[model samples]
Target: MKSICGDLLLQRLGPEGLGAFGKPLNRGLYECIRGAILDGSLPRATRLPPQRDLAAELGLSRNTVMYAYEQLLAEGYLRARTGSGTFVADTAPESYLNATAAAITDAGPRAMPGLSPRGQQLLANASASPTQWGAFMPGVPDLRRFPHRRYAQISARLWRQPPPEWLSYGHGGGLPALREAVAAHLRVARSVRCDAEQVLITEGIHQAIDLVVRLLGSTGDQAWVEEPSYWGIRGVLQVSDIGMVPMPVDDEGLTLPEADAGRLSGRTEPAPRFIFVTPSHQYPLGAVMSLKRRRALLEFARQHGSWIVEDDYDSEFRFSGQPIPSLQGMEADAPVIYIGTFSKTLYPGLRMGYLVLPRELAGAFQTAHAELYRAGHLMTQATVAEFMQAGDYAAHIRRMRPLYARRRAVLAALIERYLGPGALNAQGSNAGLHLVLRLPDDADDVAITAAARAKGIMVRPLSRYYLGTPAQRGLLLGYACVPEEDIGPAFDVLLGCLGECGHAAHVARIG
Candidate 1:
């Protein structure tokens, strides 16, 4: 089997001979092996030739062959037989194909029994999902310009003189050092008031949302989400099979008048058990939930015995005045879950975030954490903890705050210049990386975004984020990925698309 597999691999390496570099073979051999695996030339249970044998055949190191096999195994496309030998996992994910075929039948989704009906719907929709940003998309930080070299330096420092205890599995909550650093950072950055014990680190704000949703309301219970809210969070709620009640948001944010909550209008016919809001800077529309509204929401949540989930995704860089206090900090009672993410503040690839649970709920969350994912990577957590405790994270944020603020200003100025007055109406430009680009009423942003993509420009349609009513029809263009010099040209091209689509009449007058 190993010899046959080698012959098959050799056939794929027809044109470019195997060349060695680093631990993995050079581009030629890597592609050859990858192509064979993709094309099914190496069948299931075909144990690969021992590393030494193949290395000799291809003039490569045994380590190179081993590295390729390790990558394949990590990606779930192959399996190792321990000391016995390595072989392809069962030739295909036969179960996946059968499940997919079943999903298309009236039998109603057989492949992914793990997903509920709502989860199935979200998955189906995600299949055709487009780019993450639309024109003038707000709330996304410019991650392309992040200091990768600085982070590499920090990682190197931790590796040089590693702490023996940092290698163990991180605590269910988080590394105590990171938690302490997060608490101090929050105090200075967002005015959040809490001790380290209050913080429960999770994967991202989405996971924090899920943990809170599952902990607070079970499947089929009413959960109030802001209208024109984060669709990702809504999808998470849907997958959990929870009943979602869309609450109307005003300039102040989600307004459930004490009278409004109890009386139950058409929108709130079914009472909500909890309210999910992005008060610091409301998503999409960019409206800052007012201080008055924040107090009102807390009062209402307390009165109705409902929990509040505050997703403070990008509240650190408020350009104008002081940042608003988190609902968790302002709560008079014990029912708010405050979630934060380092994805935007640092880099999304870090994959670390935390949920600040109310004191009453921390014990239950700790119990739930044990069953999910076992424990987080202790080394990364410890390194990050050092980054924060040593004042590097705060210094990084200070440097980024002005850099991002300038970008926001440049984008705003460009919007004012090229699009003209009223061509775009923006909210939450006072903070956050992206802003809303409200388009003309009749414009079909979905079609417009498709047109932009053909020109190598990308934007997100606002309709993608909402469910109840077709929220505003406009694009969400992220400014974070576009460079400072490219902003003008990008918008010009974007504006040209709008004009080509016949919406230029509404836009041309604005500039």
Candidate 2:
């Protein structure tokens, strides 16, 4: 019996070598003997040779063999009677574990469980583009031109002597220094009325709005959003089980919802509890909110006790005229939650943004944000603060402003020359990084978008932005990320696609 066990041990530790298991000699020896015992090569009540004898036979040091024996004994794989040598344990996990593995192997493949209702709804109305980078992918910026060298230097410097708080999860919105830097910048640049205490750091606008919705929004409540606004927040609201009322937008931003006396225009719906607006440069349309409309919206929110959520997403690179002031700062004690993100100004991967809450809500939001999101990215916040302090952030934006303006000009001119003068959206006030190319209302924009995608150009159908009946057919052409020279070639491909789709500018003009 001892010979049988020894033979099996040698077989396991033999041709493959003792180091075959990628473990130390002792651990390897222990594993080999334990496996032999579990497989019943050494039966219960079978006495074995002394440790020294096994060591001699195996060509291992006495202590290595001793260590292997000790481990087996400790793990109940082997036992020693006071007067007898070590033997295999009376029972082992082999009977149960081996039976389980065999049963599972015989059971064959399995189908995954079904998703929850919430999970199903999330997949239903997807907004993100599969092809994120290319000639005309909308909302993506030029990552190639980011100031990586300066950011790296700034990051390295801060990491060398970082304050302890910068290395850990933060409380009180974010690092104080970062909040102060953001506050100072927003006040001068966007004319937002906020102090350092009111600014709360976030991962991005997504997380910022998630916090807002979770904190303020109730399930089954209604919110008003621009008909063709960014799909992100609407998705957030939907997942929260909040209903969306798509308000129409024109040349002066979101048109006030029509009056049916006290109810929503043309419907019996109640007034919205929340209003989401992109005032500076309306997302797809690029219509700046006129002073009259902005004032009217504020008064409505004030009168109805509704919260106004202002998403100042990409106003930093405004290329024409003086900058539009933020809707939040225009009124004292305004019921506004101001959201801004660095996704547009800096690279999207940075995932840094801030919110300027109404003064009363600041402290509660800081606590709630820390509790809900477990706020992190202290190192990123610190680095951005250092960059701002050194004026690199401002300088970077200044450099990028003109670069984007030049790209926009080039793309706009190309559209004019190739697609004709009426190709552009007249309401798209020459400011943002993209241009909305108008199309015939009768044309099938979804079909055109698919055709353009097949031709290797990435433009979103303007109709896809609308939650209600699409008012127009068009394409969103993003030039910021596209190289200046490549814009022409890409537009040529797109123009050909327009012809193939039979929705060219001439058709729209004739109709």
Off by over 4 Å in 1: 1-116, 127-139, 161-165, 257-268, 332-334, 508-511
Instruction: Show pairs that collide, candidate 2.
Output: none
Worst-scoring 10-residue span by lDDT in model 2 = 96-105
Q: After superposition, how far is residue 231 of candidate 2 from its true place, in Å?
A: 1.0
lDDT of 1 by residue, 347-456 (tens): 77688999777667777787787576566676788778877877777787788878777777787777667666565545544777775666776788888978888887
Top model number, TM-score: 2
Q: Write the per-residue lDDT of candidate 2 for residues 1-511, one digit (tens) a residue.
A: 3465667678777687688889999999887777666556677777777888887777788899899989888877778888888887887655545652123124767999998888788788787888888889888889898889999998998789878876777899999999999999999998899999999999999899889888888998889999897888878888888899998998899988654445556767777889999999998899999999999999888767789999999988789799999999998889999999988888788899999998898999999999988888898988899899889989988988898899999988887776677778888886777899888778888888899999899999899789889988888988899988898889899889988877664643622
Global lDDT of each candidate: 0.72, 0.85
- For model 2, the superposed segments whose C-alpha errors exceed 4 Å read 1-104, 108-112, 258-267, 505-511
TM-score of each: 0.76, 0.79
